[model samples]
Structures are given as C-alpha cells and as structure tokens.
Target: MQTQRSFAKQTTGTLYLVPTPIGNLDDMTFRSIKVLQQVDLIAAEDTRNTQRLLKHFQITTRQISFHEHNTQARLPQLIATLNAGQSLAQVSDAGMPSISDPGKELVIAAIKHGIPVVPLPGANAGLTALIASGLAPQPFYFYGFLPRKTQQQVAALAPLKNRTETLIFYEAPHRLLKTLASLSLAFGEDRQIVLARELTKKYESFLRGTLAEAKAWFDQHQPRGEFVLLIAGNPYPQTRADAYQHLNLHDYVAQLVTEGHPAKTAIKMVAKQRQVAKQEVYRAYHQF
Candidate 1:
C-alpha cells in the first residue's frame, strides 16, 4: 500500500528562487517580499547586502550567507534544513540568484533531494539591456562578466565575436574602457556595440555606434556605475563580389591556438573573430 502526495499535505519542502532589485528597491516585487517573509530561511550571496534589502521591506526572515566562496560547504547544511521539511528561499545581493552569481549548485542539490524549486520573478539587468538595446531578442548570449586582466578578457571575447546572436557582457565602470578596447581588437573597429551604464539609476546613459566611434565617446565622458555591453549579431555572409577585405583566417587561428585554445577550438574561435564560417577557418588550417 502506498500514499500519494497532495499539494497541501506533503511535507516535501520547496526552494524559492527570488529576484531582488538590481539597483532600485522600487523594482522589488510584492510577491518577492511575501515569499521572503514566509520562508523558513533565506540563503543570500551576501548577507550584509541582503540585510539592507530585508530591512527596507521589514522582512525578519533568518538569513544564511551562501555565496561562491562558501557555497560548496554550505550546500549540505542548507539541504539538511530542506530535508527537515522547511521551505527556503535563495537570493543574490541584486537581481536573480545564479544568473551570474550564486544559486546554481544549491538549486541542483535541492533537486537531487526531491525538494521543489520555484521562481519568484523580478528585475534582471541582463534582460533589461537586451530588451532596450533594440537588438535581436530571440537569440542572445549573456556573458556575465569578463576576466579582470585585459589580455585574458580579450581572449574571452574573441570566441564570441562570430556568434550570430546578440552578445551581452557585464562590466564595472573602472574596466569599461579597457573592455571596449579589447572588443574592438577582437570584433573590429566597425563592429556595432551598445553600452548601457548605470541602468535603473539616476545617471542612466546609452552610448551606441561602431567600436571606434564608441571609444571616442567614452574617452570624453568619465564612466561610473555598472554597465551592460551589448554587441550586435554578426553580419550575413558576404557575396563574392561584395566580399570585404579582412585578416586571413589561418594566420588568426594559428595565433590563438598558440594562445592556448586547441587547434579545433582555435579554428572556430578565429572564425568568430573574423566573422566567417568555420569551414573558412578549417580550410585555412588545413592549407598551412
């Protein structure tokens, strides 16, 4: 004989994925605050930052610090609470948890233990920029943030240059200009780029144009606050008569392969940076 679980009677605990305001408290949803209040525990990436947000809504829910550094050690403890039949919610300092922050590992653990995971939707800067960037919305890649070093950052963006879908990158104000310079090197001077700075804040600004034009724009304006960089999708394949002059694919792939990407991956990467087909790169690799 077995008993089936019902919506109300089951002791099976639930995990709520709540989204917090990225920069503005007004963006916090009523549903988010309600869930925060009712949950047995709140797992936060930054307990200090969460404290500020919680205080604003008068939420007194107990919070446990759960961020990248402590997530591995903290998962088992958090899961034990869930297994004990206590519902919990996880949040980041801002935006949805695990988008580019903590929450992925914790959510996976809860699922393995048969705990239900629910999403309490709210604001997200990534989607905010994508929607307002006025670029192709259906297909896009969100590159949360780049490596701090200029060389490493450029190598990271190198692989995304050829993706036919819109690309997004999160950058701190201090690194915005250097990041843009790296983008121009990988994507080309004429590539279209959109910069959304201090979004949802008092000094929100959008600067858009070719990479060269954008570099000039930023040179004059001092940047301050969070930024979302949206680079337009790659251009359509070129016709023979209209083919534009560009760097040779083989030489480019050889260079990147030397920089540590495997030969196959390098071919694909260079194709992206050159905005051409993988076959274009493959042929060049085999030629030399």
Candidate 2:
C-alpha cells in the first residue's frame, strides 16, 4: 500500500533497483548510469563482476557485496543507509535485481520502513528473448527458473502446463537438455518452444522448434551460455464431456489419493490438467 514517485524530491535517500547489461555493455541505459554515479553506494551481487561494468563507464562509486550468502547480515545495514538519506543502488551480476537474485528482501525492508524505491529499466534477458521468440509476448508469464531436481521441476511446471499465456524461463547450459526433456514430458513433445542463448553477445542464437526437436537438437549439440526458454501455452479447450470422463473433481482427487499422491499435490495437478484455478479445485475437491 505504498506509492513511489521516483523523481519526487524526498528527505530520505532512495533505493534504486538498477538493471545492468545482460551481455552487451551498450545496453546500459543513460539514466541507470546517472543513478549509479549519483548514489552513495552500490550494493552489487558480485562486486568483482560489477567492477568491469563500472570500469567501462568510469564510474568510481563505491560498491559493497550483497549476494545470497550475505543478504541476511547486509539487509538491515542497507535499510539503515537508506534511512540516513544516503542513496544506494542494488544490481545483480546481470539484468534486474530481485529477479532470481538477492535484492527482494532489501527492497521489501526499504518499503516497510518508508524508504523510496526507484527502479530504472535498462536491460533484461527475459523480455529481450521473448520479443524475438516468435511467441505471444503481451500475455507472457516470466518464471525465473525451474527446480533443479527432476521430480521437483515436473511438480513446479504442473500448474503452468495449461496456461493460455506464453511461458518464460531461465536455465543454465549444463541443465538445458534435462530441462527440455522435462518440458516435453510435462507439456508434450509437439508443444512449440524457443531457446535464446548468449543473448546480445557475439554468439547469440535462437533455437526454435517443438519440445521433442529441442530435446533432440540439444542431445546432439553441446549446450553453452545462459538460456531464455519461451514455450507456447496450452491450446486445448476443456469440454464438459472431458470433465465427465475424468469422473468429476472430487472423484479425481480421491482417485489420485488412492494412488498414493498427496492430497495437496493431487489437487494442484488436477487443477492444472483441468485448466482451472487451484483454489476452485481445492474447494470442489474438499466439498463432500
């Protein structure tokens, strides 16, 4: 319930969520540079990595480490700095802070303590890949990364299996093939998906095809660089006949439970398979 007028004059120093170049240095925005230059301190995920960007722009601003390992110890200090009218900018190794990074807690603390939070948009890999992904961009959902374990990844992707909007995900090179196979299992082999890697860099390329083809391609080729995966959403329409065939929501949950699946997990899977809200599925399943 907080409103932030980014440009408004304020007594306390603002907390800036600055986005760094995902791959190309030229993608850094002019406003981001000015904010970084003006801020009292820069809380970077990796000071060593960020130093390269700072060196490129000749920004001599002091930086402090604020990564996943040190967030618990550093969040309070960052909030205190903002309260003291000393502006601080938070940046990840690349792209936006708090997007699978370590700034979400600090930002939340700043907001709770009445400190202004300003976000300067510059470069992000998700949207950068999505626009050129040849998928529907407007109604897209950005899921930062999937679970590492195979079972967990499958469970995490269950609810998203039937979404109408396009889906976005981040994955490392080593796990690319396994993730593609998992996607094929969850969404079927024929679903369309695109893999954009080495984005905005010299070797940047986009691999587009069905999930099966993607799995095959990666099987044959060695994966390299970070990837932004965009997958087409479920296109199948649910029908009343389909509902009857599945023995209704209650019976479906009961059937899943009888087969040894946890009640909560079963409800979620059923909800996803039926293309309905989880809450709706929960209520209907629980209603005796």
State each model's CA lDDT, in order.
Answer: 0.84, 0.89
Worst 10 residues of 1 by lDDT: 237-246
Each candidate: RMSD to true structure? 5.8, 4.9
Report the C-alpha lDDT of model 1 over 147-235, residue by residue, as the tens digit: 99988987787657667889998988888889889999988899888888878888887888888998898899888889999989777
TM-score for all models, in order of appearance: 0.81, 0.86
TM accuracy, model 1: 0.81
lDDT of 2 by residue, 177-260 (tens): 889888998889999999999999999999999999998898889999999999998889444336446588888888778657
- Highest lDDT among the candidates is held by which one? 2
Report how far off residue 85 is in candidate 1 (Å). 0.7
Q: Enumerate residue pairs that collide in model 1.
A: none
Over 4 Å off, model 2? 237-251, 254-288
